[model samples]
Target: MKLTRHMMPLLVMIALLCCSLNGFAAHGEKKPEKKAILLVAFGTSDPEARKVFDRIDEQTRKAFSDVEIRWAFTSKMIRAKLAREGKVLDSPETAMARLMSDGYTHVAVLSLLSSARDMETVAGTLMKNIPGRKPEDAVIFMGHGTGHHPADAIYLAMNQVFQEIDSRAFVRTVEGNLRELDISEIPFERPTRF
Candidate 1:
């Protein structure tokens, strides 16, 4: 296989083809990890809470860069009842559906759960619905969690929500009295849940 005038260009072409094939394989091989963060609120019919929740949504977006993030009312009943009353809301289901349809692979849900009671259940159940998504994907739910409040139900509720979402996703609940907590010690952290 001595290099001749004709063979020189032929060998060069072969080398180029091999390099391109390698480049294509390398570039097309890895599937980038998908992620998103969602601020899930118990939602407000009060219209006043809407203003407060607006701040939460804005802050969460600024925190999680490169991760597709947005807001939603986790309480379908609250959202339904109020949306009819002209709150003009996007339900968590609707929001999640839009994100997934728009090519989001995972969504981290931050719930507006001041008191565990119905609010946590409302948010958790709605977030759990995120499981039946097309392909297996993660849906995170962050609770406002239990604090030094008189009632103990909030922590219990957060634990319950954690149980529901943990099997599918890496979930976390931040109650002041608990371990492994994140985002604790805020003024409105212990607000009365209506």
Candidate 2:
């Protein structure tokens, strides 16, 4: 077969394109972005409440071992709640800031607010201002999903925001919140005055 000038160039270009595509498709050729998991708990001074968050932290860590793990108490009000009753959170801020300064470049925050109200508002304010982090990428906040609370509607609303994966959003609450579908169904170990 006689090779024409145009045909010869076209064949070389096709070969190059094929090789590039195969290199991209190969596994281990490109590394997936590493992610970090942060579990945010409502600040609690109550011994029992501490246990609840501890269990939550443990479970979350186990579930996402591939991701770097971190924790934050996420709520000043909750810490105040425990303090007003003569209790103190052991390491709320330390845990939060340490995670920020540590090796993980991206941090996912999981809040323990019963209704996600505090996480969406108060916690939102601080997450925006993490000392050395970006609101859009560096820090992420996640909320525990409720399963038995009557306020399942709130969870539904939150689910809408957290659904977009590209955006820094999350949807979750304890299972009971969904199961009960009513606020009254939530069993509060310590009552809030407001």
Candidate 3:
């Protein structure tokens, strides 16, 4: 077969692709990589509220006994609000970067927030299109308690986003706010005190 100048580059590309695939196949089948668990939440400044977070941490540690666990706060506003009160917290980006730098190959993110947007972002980062690492193997996201706030329409919206990306993903709620909340029905003319 006669090879043209343009055909040379195409042939080289095909040859490289084949060689790469063959090399991967030659290494034989690999076992699933171990994963670390990252529990993410919108942290609080109140000492009393912090106990709830602590309890969640304790329960997660007990359940995932074999996995390495870490904590991250997804709210910059909440983090900043806490920092002003003389506390510091790590964001998901900061925590994940540190974990990757420490040679962690896989991560499973669990969000303690009613919303799934931040959790989805972390799951996306962990489950990237990298060679030798299956996206499904690297990460998972669990959104906790989609109720309790008047502004929880955000959680419903986020569930749709997760459904579009991964059918296995979902949102759940526990003990939602007791008050009947209908934004359209509520009259907002007067200033209310907390």
Candidate 4:
């Protein structure tokens, strides 16, 4: 089953709750639970993009000051690219293994990107709240797509959902099957004259 962005925090909370309860159930004195948060990203080789990641890391550290924070990059290509420049980043698996070896009882992994449903909600809300938007005005959302991955279908699905939410709203991708979507296919209606 696919895990949604909205579910990540809930799952983390539940894991923490379970860990606390389990500690209480122990026969002897309670043991302190070691918890950590692992932020995973697709990663980019661009030095400028590293600033954004730094900001996220800073904010996460501030928010969870007591909990240990770590990072992992999911893209092997990006990791290798960085490695060539004498910088190394751990893969998600490697990061998790290290945390386990360090005796972290609970590790929460968080990643960017929302699930299809969450994307739909965001699109719908945006379409509804546009300033001075007319019925004939069209709103298009552009996204990056994995050219050949099965996940590319998410772009098409989101496009369909956007159109359903507002016939004038549409979605397009930069590098996917729907990248060449014809404008004529979009259901754009002309405003009616009184």
Candidate 5:
């Protein structure tokens, strides 16, 4: 019935603790879904190339308005060169690790590479290996292909490579399309294995 100054602080803290517990009980039953988009690129040291990268990044952010956007460069040499110029670049591995630590439940990666290179491999491996990364998650690589070059087949080959590993991963080109491959079926769910 009697309260002193020393007891007041203790009472207030106890009340706050009760409120916190109530808050947790009310909302902590279900975790909030955290989603992110990571745009991976080979990265360039040239200003013009950087401008193109920036434009692509901006467009991607616009398209994926809800999810948080991050960037990673797959080229170590380009990263080093940019670092010398006072620019920071996160590698694909680094970005994925950070996203996992940040509690993202779903991640969609869009890589701006012309062909299946080291970056594509890294993206595919990370998507497959990231703990708790689900079938709903997507990894897409965009390439610049030309009809005049035989190298355009690389994109189709990479797409097949992704399909074999996980259906959610896809590779496509701006100027190329494979008759056997359909872009409409991207972000596909994998068949359950018994």
Candidate 6:
């Protein structure tokens, strides 16, 4: 079956989880693996943004029918905001703790910000979805970067991939020292094109 952009990340995550479980099983432990999937995201306070998470949750549940699925938010601020509004969300640590306590031996934590391959799929999807996009029109994607983490390199790699795919495509970070394409250098005649 052909994977959609939204499902690509989930498939990659499932493959990784399967590999991990297989490796653990190879160790000769007799305990049955109680598998679970934890979907982690930076999260958002906006109701509209929350819809994306809901969709992901629904899709994950459908994909892993037998496995339990849960969610955690990485952003403390977002969590706090939601909590104040009477919606409780768990942190990654708390979620993992709960999973362990519930006897989930094999828990796969899937982050919303996926690897370069998944990001490439998302970028391509975004470009294709743009209404009446032109060959000369540029598409710039802004991503939230982990300041000091090694994962920050993914942004750089994605930027390079975006450039390689189409010189008009660009990626920038909201919080990182990573060098991005200079927006000032790109001449923008039609504001609508952006």
lDDT of each: 0.54, 0.49, 0.56, 0.74, 0.65, 0.75
How many residue pairs in model 3 have overlapping backbones?
0
TM-score of each: 0.40, 0.34, 0.44, 0.57, 0.45, 0.74
lDDT of 1: 0.54
Q: Which residue runs of candidate 5 sit more than 4 Å off their true CA positions?
A: 1-29, 113-194
- Residue-pair clashes per prediction, in order, are 1, 28, 0, 0, 0, 0
For candidate 3, give the lDDT: 0.56
Which candidate leads in TM-score?
6
> Tens digits of per-residue lDDT for model 4 on 80-182?
9999999898877677667765667788877654576667776777787878777877677776666756667777888878877876677777777777666
Which segments of candidate 6 are over 4 A away from where they belong? Answer: 1-32, 179-181, 184-193
Candidate 6 lDDT, 51-158, residue by residue in tens:
978998999999999999999887778899999999999977677767766767788888775777787786677777877778778877787776755667777887
Residue pairs clashing, model 6: none
Candidate 2 lDDT for residue 117: 64
Query: How far is 77's C-alpha from truth in model 6 (Å)?
Result: 1.3
TM-score of 6: 0.74
Q: Which stretches of candidate 1 lie over 4 Å from their true place?
A: 1-32, 85-88, 113-194
Total backbone clashes of model 2? 28
**Mind sharing the TM-score for model 4?**
0.57
Q: Model 3 compared with the native: what TM-score?
A: 0.44
Compared with the true structure, what per-residue lDDT tens digits does model 1 show for residues 67-176?
88777764557778976776666765566566655555455555556454655566566664764553234344554433544333555555556545453433345554
lDDT of 6: 0.75
> lDDT by residue for model 3 over 127-168, one digit each (tens)?
454346432331223333325344445555555565556543
